[model samples]
Target: MKDGLKQRLVAQARAEGFDACRLCRPWDVRHVPERLAAFLARGYHGQMGWLEERSQWRGAPEVLWPQARTVIMLGESYTPECDPLAGLEQKTSGNISVYARNRDYHDTVKKRLKRLARWLIDAAGGEVKVFVDTAPVPEKPLGQAAGLGWQGKHTNLVSRELGSWFFLGSVFTTLDIETDPAEVDHCGSCRACLDICPTKAFPAPYQLDARRCISYLTIEHKGPVAEELRPGLGNRIYGCDDCLAVCPWNKFAVAAREVKYHARADLVVPKLADLAGLDDAAFRERFSGSPIKRIGRDRFLRNVLYAIGNSGEGALCHVAQAHCEDADAAVADAARWAVLRLRRDANGLE
Candidate 1:
């Protein structure tokens, strides 16, 4: 009976737009707490204070809800239609990560997880609670614990079929579902994801220093980027995809079938000047449904200014100059730094 119910859960998940699903006991990720403790001790999480605050709940899913007997891990692919790294050469334009190029996955994936959860409750008669990345759950480790995928060296889940281009979701339930075999690491000796990081964010083979990650710097970070790391950003105005795009496993990744995951024409490679022109109102309107909107106008411009400083296109100096006195001090600071960098390039300084 448990086996039959678990199979039905997987089928329902796939039918609701999830690419993969697997079951695990709530306490399956035994080693995650230790790894997280070490990571937090090293202060690798940076300003994400909440990760530390919710360490108790994040460290033990069973402790989070003792009554929940099982966890159903789900993965949904949002693989880019074309090469994500190709935007790097288009230096005059901004490069947003492939994940953010489409509609926010949190909402899209959660809706499906909810549908699956509702089905599980109705058919199997169990209480359920769902979580996407919005929670402090150790999803990558849990995903591995449930056989969804292994946590690659980049610390993102990588599967034989989905590579690194997927989002994870979870349904915690009171049902005693049959668990799947845990996935084992298959990264071998390859370090493509680690080496491709422009900021060298990896402290070791599989460890990441979030402070140096471009994705963190451009999004969660609230102020001017550390001056030394700004040039490493290239023209990436949002999250960086270098690590994920360089993974060898991506050869197995097929393009995403969901229409919402398709890139909008303007966002594929937006002109730096055009992006820099966005005022607060325009920024909100332009990014209404985008994950980029969460950072708000000031943080968004701060990232764009960093990209401008890195562009080497002296013509954009005037665009940066216009924002030198921006209301947000961090944005103004970024503008001043960008103008200085572009001016130095104009003067033939190496």
Candidate 2:
């Protein structure tokens, strides 16, 4: 009866549009503590202090919700129809991460997880909790334990069917469900992701130093980006996708079926000039329901200015120069730096 009900739940997850569904016993992720400790010990997380504060709950799911007997892991693909790397050639254009190019996944994935959780409660009569990235849960390890996928060398979950372009969400329930066997790592001598990192953020396979990660530097780090690393960031205004884009498994990735996740035309290759001019109000209005809003106008402009500097197009020099007087020091400094870079590149400064 337990195995039959688990199968039905997995089928329901697929019918509800989740790309894949798998189960793990709540206790399965308990061994993550040692790995988490090592990651922290190496200072890999950088200034993201929250990862340190939530260490206990992050490594052990049972610590967060003891009543949970099973965890249902779900994957939803957000692969773009076009090659996400194509924009990198256009030095003047900003490269937003493929995932952030559409509506925020937090809201979209959370709503679906809630619907699935409610159905489970109604069917089995049990308490449940749902988590996206917002929680302290060690989602990647949990996903692996559930047999959804193994964590690739880049530390993101990669699946045989959907690759690494999918977002993960989990539903924890008190109902005892049969757990699935864990997926084994298939990376196998493949160093494509590591070699492709522009920022060299990965210290070694399976370990990431967030301090040098473009995603963390641009999105999580509050102050100025490290000087030496700024140029390598290029036109990437948001998170970096170079690592994920080069993965060989992505050949199987299908375009997202959910229309809401489809990339917005405006966001695909936004005009750097327009992005640099956004004030707080304009930024909020433009990025409504988008993940880009979380970084706010100042940081967004800072990133844009960095891209403008790297663009090597003299046309955007004026745009960067205008922001040199922005109210935000970070934006203003970035703008001033961009202006200098543009002038140097144009004039062939000695």
Best by lDDT: 1
Model 1, range 232-341, lDDT digits (tens) per residue?
Answer: 99999999999999999998886687788889988998999999999889998999899999999889898888889989999999999999999999999999999999
TM per prediction: 0.98, 0.97
Model 2: residues with Cα > 4 Å off, grouped in runs: 1-3
Q: Model 2 clash tally?
A: 0
Candidate 1 displacement at residue 233 in angstroms: 0.6
Model 1 vs. true fold: TM = 0.98
Tens-place lDDT digits, model 2, residues 225-306:
8778889999999998998999999998877999888889999878898888787899999999999999988898899999
Q: What C-alpha lDDT do the candidate models reach, one value each?
A: 0.91, 0.90
* Candidate 2 minimal-lDDT segment of 10 residues: 1-10
Q: Distance (Å) between predicted and true CA of 215, model 2?
A: 0.9
Task: Quote the RMSD, in angstroms, for model 1.
Answer: 1.0
